[model samples]
Target: MNLKQFWQNFGEAAVYYPQLAQKMGGVSAAILYQILGRWLNQSSTVQCSLKEITDATGLSEAEQKLAREELKARSVLEFKLMRSQPEIYSYTLNFEQLEQLILNDSAVEKTSTVKRDPYFPPRRQPIAVSVTPHYQFSGPWRSQQQLEAFQDALLSYAKQQGYSNPGGWVFKIIDGISKGIKSPFWDEFIAEKPLGSSQKIQQEWEIEPGVPYPAFESERIQYYTHKGEPLESAVAKARSELRNPVKAKDLWEGFLRKCDRIANDALKAKKAGVETPYLPPSFSEQSTVTKASVMEKLSQLQGDSSLLEAENPPEKTLSEEEETSSDIPSLESLNNLYQSPITQNWVEEQIAKHPEWGYTIREGKVIDQYPF
Candidate 1:
């Protein structure tokens, strides 16, 4: 057998059907195909023994048999067993059938938009629901009455922390504690405040000496007025600075620096006669832009007369054109047409078309052929 010829055939087959190795029983079948091609000699048929195939492909006897069965089932190979030795078979590669199957599979794959491997199961999507901070516990409380009571007490504790709605995080914390998931926060919270207790918990958990809870809305407004900063920016900066405990003096200093920069910018803009873009916090408190303003802006941008007309349209009345369109084939004209002999003949012809209707014309008058 010519090794070069065998390799050439193998490469050609691989190029023609790139997925063949995987689709047709994997590596062992691919190796066997190449070995058979080497012994093919200018003919489609190759005479090979089971031992020869096993030796060439390094597949066990069982694997070799399975590969042959898969190749035949795929219409890529056919073989005839010899009468003398069933183990030795005359094999023929159905090149035409193999090529056809490959083309058909390719066409099918191209038509499918969502490509997924047939070998593996599809993955499931995660369940998602909107959770709000202010949501109260509404429970059936059948077997979980204790959990519900604990949740109510947790909500009361959260309210003392200035959170109107303690949010989903509180529930997650409580759930973790109930499930025996250990955490320092859970340990301290539970130890300091027992379940169903309305009394204030002791201040065992202390904030650092000079650290303060973040600034309130009133303080944020005061900072915005003094600093000439955007109220949003001032609020965001204060929240960021006080997110974790820092020295109270340090937090105040950061706030002051931000205010100084903003105030200087405002002064510079005023000196240059450039109007400051930042609005006062009071202006921000006003109601949002009305729908009419939005519509006016859209009309201006689109430059559409129809949109403007639609916004403040006049009372509608039927125009001459609409009135003329409505007078389609007057009733008197339709009655005259119905009295004509041509109309009668056309109607009779239509009835004659359906023999199943059992209608017959006798002396120029129609009647049902079959009557119950």
Candidate 2:
């Protein structure tokens, strides 16, 4: 049904004349004002019936009573009971008081801005194309336990998305660590089996009746009210989110696990006297890199004289600043090979790309808070 077709004209300023509905209390009072305002045709007073108000604004009779009490307390309106008519009431509005309220609020806003130097109003976040924002960790600056948690969470989330072995999904993340994790076959894998479609809505619309779906509620309001989406479409979107609440954190952990696995492998190969301890970053067909090539080249593996033909790396003196094979590879040594200055710049780039981590990186220098 087109609810807008039956819309009535009213004072727009009433909703936020003094402050927002949330700041003032609830939207009940503001909604009450709109209903009464529509009936006042060049008159301050209007006879309003509770039944009529309830029919116009979906507000119950008890809600209307509380709204009237709030409006009277704010001095924006005064209502009197009509004799012999329990459902009817006469409302008298104060236009001067409402105008004064708006003027005072505007003055406060201007003064606050002037007092606060270097003030920047909050920027509206860019709309996400996906229902949920995905988080990825290409570097292993975190603990092994944390990495395992990320892997488990990622696999669980991918399962929810109906993907079998979501390692390809994790591997496609824009970093050189794709070959490190469960993504040796990533190039041909996800291309063949893409992520599955979202789950269907419940045939019975009773997704735990009486309990409000919090994540779905936020999405529903944005879609239905702000984006002007149809009620049916909004309901479907909300239900989908309610079922699949999180995706980013899962991906974040999974990729981190892969990086850690790669780092551990490199450390083991280094200790085993392997000539080429590290895998080449690229895994494309043109790239002359294979897991078998590196595994065969391992000097610790005996009986392969052909693989032994590979030349050893030149011996280099270790500086105090340089880490040995015994030492766990720092963020700089593994994924990021640059020094502090360049590494710090990369941190800023990551923050910009993943605005979802904005809260965690706010307190200190972005790199400081990061495990790196």
Candidate 3:
């Protein structure tokens, strides 16, 4: 068939395997056309390895694999060993050509010349490629259980949003944590930081933050849309719409879970005479004091009344000396006073956008509120 006719048939096949059409590049498609057309005209098998085809067509290995699968899936080509030499044997379609009428000519038919194995047939194994975008984790996490809790929290959030693959979603979560990738979760995590403050920055600036979490791809099957939409789109949608704001509100809850796990590990570690005690901020929050009160007490410990006033204080009461003294500065302090409240409000606004956690931990137990 001519290129036009081939494409027409290929387009018809795309309803079932849309990725074949979606992933094909110009060179790879051309190579498919050339190889199939030549085989039809010459009536013989073609000897070409993946490297040779890539070199001849100037296509990359990835593109060539895509094209090869596209043709194979359509039953246009077959890969098998002929006399112990790997070769691509072209199968001619009965509708595309006329068979010779003479009895002797029947033997010359390409279909008759081809070999088949009934027991062990040539089957294509799908290659696992990284199609999802990278996710990275930030902040401090000392134990594996704490890390796992965070991952579980993300998976729960994604599933609640109707995602098809919760494992894949969890892979993205772990991937993000290991690589320090800037995700919506991290965006929300840093939102509460004090203004003009630099948050905990990772050391290696050159590293690709989106690197897939180690063992993540191997541990689970990646998600793909039935329509064959790119995996990246699903991840993008998950980070922005499905998981973000909800994940932000779930931060303290996730942190608490992580803390419980950390506390268990810490108890074990302490029994082993390990001095380090790992506790999430939520665990600290559980004591009779809140973060605000802790900050107040810490300020008192430091003997800095100004620090206490900055964190918590009664309504403003300016002394005549502080009001009139140019040495105290006014405009800069006024700007800071206004800016801090606005930043705090914005952080609270992001938290307020989160969807309520509705997943069941088990039967009759659902996480429906934050900071539990």
Please write out the lDDT profile of model 3 over residues 240-326, one tens digit for every residue: 331233543354355446556877899998999989776533234334446666545543454443533433335545884356333
Listed per model in order, the count of residue pairs whose N, CA or C atoms clash below 3 Å is: 1, 2, 9
Question: By descending TM-score, how would the candidates be arranged?
Answer: 2, 1, 3
Pairwise lDDT winner, candidates 1 and 3: 1
Residue range 252-321, candidate 2, lDDT tens digits: 3554566578778989998899877775332112334564465444422333332222222246567632
lDDT of 3 at 356: 31
Who wins the TM-score comparison?
2
Q: Where is model 1 more than 4 Å wrong at Cα? A: 1-18, 114-372
Q: Which regions of candidate 2 fall more than 4 Å away from where they truly are?
A: 1-24, 116-372
lDDT (Cα, 0-100) at 202 in candidate 2: 35
Instruction: Report the C-alpha lDDT of model 1 over 175-266, residue by residue, as the tens digit.
Output: 66656675454344446655324332322112432233223334545665579878677766655544444443465566567667767877
Off by over 4 Å in 3: 1-27, 39-41, 81-83, 86-372
Which structure is stronger by TM-score: 1 or 3? Answer: 1
Best model per lDDT: 1
